[model samples]
Target: MEPSEDTSAVSPVTPPPGCPLHSNAVPLYGEALAEDDTERWERLRKRFGGLAPVKVEPEVAAWLILGYEEHRQILRDPHLFTHDGRISRELLEGRLRPEHGTYPLVNYRPNALHNDGAEHQRLRTALVDSFEKLTSTRVRAAIEDLANDLIDAFAADGKADLIGQYATWIPLLTLNRMFGQEDRHGYFLCELMVKLWNGEGAEAGAADQAMVEYLTRLISDKRRRPGPDITSWLIAHPAELSDEEVTQQILLLIAAAHDPTTHLIGNTLRLLLTNMDLRFSLAASVIQIEEALDVTLWQDPPFKTLIGRYATRDTTVAGYQIRRGDMLIPGFAAGNNDPILRDADGNPPHAQRPVSRAHLSWGLGPHSCPARGIAYQIAATSIATVSARLPDIQLAVDPGELRRRPSPSINGLVELPVTFAPQQPLARPHRAEPAPPAPPAPPAPTETVERPRTIGGIWDRVSGAVRAWFGV
Candidate 1:
């Protein structure tokens, strides 16, 4: 593809004294850490051009690509900018120690996200085939059921933290169900997942190890008794992935699903509640839930910056020199707000050209998110279910006081406190009470074990066993 003239060259500018580019201690957490990202990014763009240098965690300096067209070009050509996790050339050369908080981010793993060429294709194919089982209708129904059940837990109280009660739990429960895990195990996994993302010290390391062991056992169980779920589907795929490979794939899927989906729901809800025009449009049936989600994707993507990509060879991007083994971070949030794409008032220039769905929120090229459609379905259903069930719901806290979680990769709120009119629980007419059992029966001869009478019964037993074994 031809490069756009707008991104042809970046004007040269000298970095100010003690700027992020010149200092090793300056941290880069994207707009989430900025009080006002729009003004901040615009200032950075002018000062250092599009490819500005900055520091990530553990005092590692890297380049932050802030141009939309340049970001797209780098993402599209993975051969030049690979997604392998070997970002720190100094560490590989025995020049740096592995005692930093950012060690995990640069550690290589045998998964699609950390590979290129045929290996990436093989791993990604297995994942894509397994995800195909999650049809749009199935995903929508599953998320809706999970969302409603979560809301029901706090509905009578008329007030709840939407992030804890609804946004976070819906994806956790849905993903757990898809992996054929019980509610107890699901809850435990959710706790560990959060710790893995936000915890510090030995506690975080322990949580990470525990998660791997649990998933390893789950994969073994699936191999022994295959079922109609994502894990089983992956095991049965033509790729014939080993237990270790399957475990890595499962971890990737869960991690990828959890934060992004949770944030998408939270961010969209924030927009709907805070923007009167959007709420009015929804009330008047002037816009659909999908449009609301699109707006959120364009404005507040869950991942403000795509994780680091390493340069394969010396190259020039947007007229900026890039050295081999140098780390390049794609600015998804900043690129979305590129001056070339936005009007003077900081809105998308939709009137001048067709609105394209080419946003970099999901990345681009070969390594882009394979479950993009399912993500959209999950977010849309979640937002719609809550909004429809509680039309009077509103933000409980002042919008100005809301805070973002402290993470280098994720862009999400710390909490979303919301309130709604109190209402009674919905009546469940189909639920039937179990009949009373007879007096104790005689002991079975030779202590013979009884098998479940139906598929549902078998699933319940298996789920119970897994949950019990996990002590969840």
Candidate 2:
């Protein structure tokens, strides 16, 4: 499809004025400039509660669903809300209206994640089988090796940006392996996905060219030396799938697998250290680990605020009348945190929604991520392994000192600096504390003849050195 630069990428479809939620608020885009804005969110909630239909900015005119049940209803009933609304076809045919040129595609492809009906089912089944195959026992073992190798490289140094060193690298490498692409391209792939998913305009323009060139190279290589990897497999099994379809599917999978998994690792670590009881409980049981994932997904969803949908026909949702060609944004964070889903009777005010199965992190209904099982296994195993191995891997810096990534869709620490008393088998205390006498004595630190770095201080020095070298 020929690419064009037309500024009016999005235009609102006119709807009836009676809809109470009608708003001048622009649709949210690009890392959600309005995501953390509490007042705006509250206003949105109120409008949504009023059952008024509103046009959100930064997007074409779309209905906003504030009600939790209604959001779920929309997700479930795809007939009323279509994913085929993406403007790919018009662009490809050179018939795309100027206003639609800003979209990623002028002609929409019916990817599993963007379609319903039998087409969705068929695409999802093939993708799911391939993903499950990649997540088998052999893959888990390989991941463990990769993790240990990373730990070995930096664990002794007592300092490293866990996100850069491990989280991003592992997922990218995994996808590279899955696609039979060279290991060297993993980092490039990560960079491309981040740009395409996060930025637009001039930044997007540069990134788009780089990404296309990079992907084309990778695809070309895979075509020549076809292996049992997902890309090669898809290429071989092109029974009902076109090369274009396969490439798009692989692109989406690689991006989703890498970024969200990286954030999941960061989120898990954050929760583990901050909430001691939850960490200990999870360390003791596989089931608890799974439960912890559910709570985390609800509390801090990777796909936080932005949810996109388009109207297949003029439909009234959440008491608002939306016309055909309208768009919709479902606030995932809003719905996940809904009080109705919380367990008031529980010991703590935790979300009661079943962590074992029905969490919305993998999404709900027809477009639910087909890689749910793979995600669970990956998360569960990694969290369980780390928790069991390093029960005391607490953050070296103050909790507030850690920097979070600046994406609205995913929440994670950009650099997780941590220090641990090296893992050692638990030994019974040789000398138990004598009574409560220890509670009475608070002594001042003695002046030492020589000052040396404590394990914690050692990490600090290494951190300083790295920062100095990089001028960060």
Write the residue-wise lDDT of candidate 2 on 1-472 in tens digits: 1223442443434434553333453444343443554344556676556222433223234455555686788778778776664522222223333333223322244467666777777777778767655747766765654455455555556555667666766666666656775444554566654554445456655655555455455455556678777777665653466555665677667657776777776687778878877776665664476677777776666665443566667767666666555556566655655545556574222444345344456766788777766666666666655555555677778887877555434556677777765543332253232112111211222332222111011011122222211112
Q: Which runs in model 2 stand beyond 4 Å of their true positions?
A: 1-43, 50-61, 87-102, 105-107, 191-210, 221-224, 344-356, 388-390, 401-408, 421-472
Estimate the Cα RMSD of every predicted model relative to the unseen true structure. 10.5, 14.5
Candidate 1 collision pairs: none
lDDT of 1 at 320: 66
Find the number of clashing residue pairs for candidate 2: 16
| TM-score of each model, paired residue for residue | 0.82, 0.73
Please write out the lDDT profile of model 1 over residues 219-296, one tens digit for every residue: 767777888789999899898887767777887878677878989999999999999988898778787777777778
CA lDDT for candidate 2: 0.55
After aligning candidate 1 to the native by TM-score, how far in Å is the CA of 97 from where it should be? 4.1
